[model samples]
Target: MKQSSEASYPISFRKREATTLGDHLRHHNSVVIIGMKRVGISNFLRFFLHHQEVPTTYIRNGAQLLTVIVDLNDLVEREIYPFWVLLLKRIVDTLEQSKVPGELKKAGQRLFTESIQLKDLFFTVDCVQKLLGQLIDHGFYPTVFLLRFDRLSEVITPEFFGNLQRLKDAAQQRLSFIFTSFRPLYELRPDVFSKSSLSVFSRDLYMTPALATDMTTILNTLQSRYNLNLPKAVVENLVSLSGGHVQYLHLALLVAKKLRKQPETREELLELLLKDEEIVLQSEELFASLTKVEQEVILKHHRGLPFSQELQEKGRYLWETGMISSGKKEIIFSPLFENYLHRIDTPVHGGTEFTKKEHLLFSFLKTHEGILCEREDIVSAVWPETAEMGISDWAIDRLVARVRGKLKAQKSSYGITTVITRGYKLVRTS
Candidate 1:
């Protein structure tokens, strides 16, 4: 079933974030927007471009505006030629498709037509440079939003980024650019990037938010989608239950549709939420989205285990990005997500139990299932902080014994063996 109107409206719930993005645009600062996967970065960019409230925000310092959005996805190829051409096309499309002054519009169309006929890289990029200059001449600042620009990580070369940077510099910095990516530009292989091109993005806007950041907008979406009209008490419980996650919000509405006449208890609501298969499946997928090390750290956190320094650093990132909750009782935020972590290690059929440590070790070993996990490798995975402090052979053997004992105690097909002079390997038993 269709969950909600989110696809059509797409972050119609994101007023505050929209405002933040607007402020960056106002300053003519080239900005880099960092957001996590499924944080709705793409849709937010889409909504920002055509959003009714956005146009009024474009005015600043008594100046007018021209904005163009060139989605990297719109480019048919990763080559520079196609990228520049697509950017030119979107700019020209903006001129033709928007309500710009007729004089500037006519000039842009004429320039774009000539550039396209040339079918040349230098000419196409030059057309873009000229268009921005024209907008400036006409008392307008040109802002370009490059959506999914991370795709250009490989497409970026010393020459391409260098030339683009020079174009912006040549425009007296009146030209603004906003690039959206799941990671920071430095993390995206800056080796090939020209330093000059990269430095103009002096502003970093993290679009990831606290659970409550857009809470009201979320409630409004659900309330309208399911025709919900509720008391303040119920709204409070729903807020606590949804944990600011949209999937949970959508399912909460579905559950509300079924049981609104019944009750408003938090326990009753959470029990119902955890029972839904969609919730569990989505939670599992979200868990899968994290890197393996992250998976282990978050899982250990949910179980209240001590973290190595590296995991602590990773945990900080996960928390800052809203993947986990704040403070001592840290959670994965969504109640459904919490449920997945709980059921992940314990077996379904024979009902074998693995302690959290045993589970993490087994998971790591299983990740390299059928391969050797040397003692040093084991120390790093199972004891990251003191791997350098040195673990004794008995410490390793005892944990292996405990894990091996549990596997056999449950009469499972999975088994492990010491590699005599080396380490241990997980294996299949007949």
Candidate 2:
């Protein structure tokens, strides 16, 4: 069923004044953008463009703008000419489609019409440069081309990669490229990418599920924009449950709002939420994206079986998807999905088994079992550097206590022990 009103919950892109992924991409000259292939990077870019009310977004002291998103999925892959043709078409369309001032709009339309008349003119690299130069002539200054390459590995040949570098050089930093890929670029091909090509894409930006740094701002915007009456606690818990995944968080809230009665508990909330068809379909899609090896890794982690260190990237990806979370010691699937995974009476392993922070703490303790880890060391390892100031000794103690309780609840033999004048140690009980 359709969960919520689109107007109520807009695409959840970052606000203008705030530093967003868009802003970061815009301000920086070089960016090799990596994101979950499924999480809709294109959608966010579109939303940002729409929010700016134009194709151009102001950056660096109210100067410079642009985000031209080309979904490679919509275009034929492994071909250069067709890709360029389609790309030029998209840029022209965006300029025509955008609500830019009259001159820019006319310029865009003119580019579109001229390019169409020229037909195969943009088939060559120089021709493509000429086309973009025309846009510059028309005043589309400092435009950032956001190319959404579905399976970048498939499209990116050594020749194609070099071509992209040439395009960047041709545009003279006026054109910055943001390419998306499912797996890491290095994993795709180390040899094909020349040093010059690598240098252009040297600044790698890993796109996580959502911008965790902007969660507070996002939550605040949601509450105000939607006029939601959710208690601060409820809102905070929603953040926790969603793991700051933008879409999942949006879906969860929509489901929460759809419930006939207000949910007094998290279980009640989940029950209401899991009923949404969209949620289930999205969850299935997430699982489907995993390879057998990836699936095994998740299943093993769920069952408390060991996963390889080599799969850290995969694990991190899964965690970003909100399907699983990492504890300091283990990876855990989301309880909502974990419960669904185990219908019969077999015990599910680590999920909701520990908070993310606690998991980090426990993971550290587990790794350092029998060694006394000072509070300072623990804080440094588990918490973000920015958060170190707020995390006091008492805060660490409380977190350790929570970990101890969770361990006991799981009937696990592992526990933490405080050492006088030292720190703490992870111990196993018979």
TM-score of each candidate? 0.64, 0.58
lDDT of 1 by residue, 1-430 (tens): 0122443443434666677777767777888887554455654555566555455753335556577888765554557788888888888888886677898788878887898788888988888888888878767788888877776776677687677678788889788888887566766766764345466544667765435545555666668755778766667676777676654565566666677364568787778877764455456556754677878888887888888987778656577567776677666776667777888866356235886557878998999999998877887788663343234344567678878989899897889988864689999997
Which residues of candidate 1, in runs, are more than 4 Å off? 1-23, 42-60, 73-81, 114-119, 193-200, 210-213, 225-238, 247-289, 327-329, 346-430
Ten-residue stretch with the least lDDT total in model 1:
1-10
lDDT, model 2, position 186:
62
Q: How far off is residue 411 in model 2, in Å?
A: 49
Give each model's whole-structure lDDT: 0.69, 0.58
Clashing pairs in 1: none
Q: Per model, how many backbone clashes are there?
A: 0, 4
